[model samples]
Target: MSRVRIFGIGSSSGDDQAGWLTIDALLAAGLQCDDAMVIEKLDRPGANLIPLLDNTAWVILVDAMQGSGPAGRIQRFDQKDWPRYTKGLSTHGFGVIDALSLARELGRLPSRIDLYRIEIGSANPGEQAGDDIQAAAQQLARCIAADLIATLLQA
Candidate 1:
């Protein structure tokens, strides 16, 4: 059972690749995952994400969004904040919130779930992520690393 799990969710698109970038930055920053930690990169996971959390105690999910925010802007939210932010908007065909709701209903959600979304202006497939989006992903990686460190310290 992994105590801490970080999942980067998105496809290989321009802004959609923000999640992948964040995880790549973290790994590049020498993030050492002991047995208790697991880092995964998910592409268009949709409802399949539920099974991935079966053994995870804490979850940090990062993804890109085409919502009402400036491109490159990063938004952080806990599970409780999901209803407020995720309406019917997402760069992917199936939004993250949809999976969250399913997980909640199926009782597969972890106790501590943190969601990070990077606002994207565009996410055309095959295009590389913009500088601003990459910068935001790096920033988000720092924030997530800090949070994970704090959690580890508490335990």
Candidate 2:
């Protein structure tokens, strides 16, 4: 059995509808907590992300990305393709590369780490993103869910 874990690193207050859409997508894809899992942060920062990563064979993260690229553009990443990132990859407290590196060092990382990232045009200075960004993030969530289903069917 393939154990798939999906983590939304931020909260609804910060992530807004993107967080809920992620949960919906997974369930809509007919995936249960037994086959997959989600971390919806309600009152904390970086909540439950580590524990979720610890038990899975594969982790597909859906996060809102900030860039000059077109909105709703979806991109993917694996450990093999992750670049040596600098100061500005994610708006979250921890950089994406650093988070993955920390998980790896702590032996909490999954065997396969895939990122389904969406590029956004604008975002709020704080935790929450702008409306356009949030919409794109939701679309990316759906795409990731579909990708997950396709992967399972192929396997």
Candidate 3:
């Protein structure tokens, strides 16, 4: 089982690509992942995400979100904060909260789960992510990298 797993979830649409871009940024930043650590990008995994959460000690999920905030605004959510932030929000169809709730019910959830959302202004098909979204992805990648380093040290 992997000790740490980071998943970037999104689609190919405009701002929806924020999660994938964050994964790209993380890779470009040269955050090395040994066998104990797994990093991947998933295209709107939804309920499919539940299976990936199995047997992981720590999990971090990144996705694009549409909120009142400006595009590229980043929000971090812990497991306890899901209820407050995820109401009536569905990314494509099924959402992270739904998958996570199922995982928790099935006893497959990791002890530590962190969710990072990048606010998006649009998800128009085939368009590239905006400059602001790209910048936020890079910033979030750096933050996540630092957090991973600290977690690894403590472990």
Candidate 4:
């Protein structure tokens, strides 16, 4: 039934790899789930993201955000609370916020949407994530994996 779907969005650049790294960590942690769970990694999906949420009961999106803070800090926002936190904040003119707004308007937004934004130190191409960001990605992935399991059990 695809009860839970997680989409990690990022490019291959420096700290932008947070989303991909989190997905890698989840796999390394040996997250076990039934066919009801789906995980994907995307590189600036843009408008292609809308259709992916169709019929999913819950959606968790992990991405990197450039903000005034030490890298690797984690912040979570729900579908309804995001606009308040990221007004006009779009990376490359299009990003999660735009995608979510489109989905909401089209009535394709999932019943539950969780956005995990990881503070990135830099997004310079070819650069790797700093130590702190790497560590945080691993920790966040583990936490999300555990939550997915608990949610699945309740279903």
TM-score of each: 0.95, 0.69, 0.96, 0.92
The parts of candidate 4 lying over 4 Å away from their true place are 32-34, 87-90
**lDDT tens per residue, model 3, 86-154:** 752445678888899899999999989999899998899989999999999999999999999898898
The best candidate in terms of TM-score? 3
**Over all chains combined, what TM-score does candidate 3 have?**
0.96
> How many Å off is the CA of 130 in candidate 1?
0.7
lDDT of the candidates, in the order given: 0.87, 0.59, 0.89, 0.84
Q: Identify the superior model by lDDT, candidate 3 or candidate 4.
A: 3
Which ten-residue region of model 4 has the weakest summed lDDT? 84-93
Candidate 2 ranges beyond 4 A from true positions: 12-20, 28-30, 35-48, 84-88, 125-138
For every model in order, what is the number of clashing pairs?
Answer: 0, 0, 0, 0
Error of 2 at 125 (Å): 8.3
By TM-score, the better pick of 1 and 3 is 3
Instruction: Give the better candidate number (2 or 4) by lDDT.
Output: 4
Model 3: lDDT of residue 63: 86
> For model 2, what is the C-alpha lDDT against the true structure?
0.59
Residue-wise C-alpha lDDT for candidate 2, range 45-115, written one tens digit per residue: 35335665776777777665556566556667777666722322565665556667777788878888887
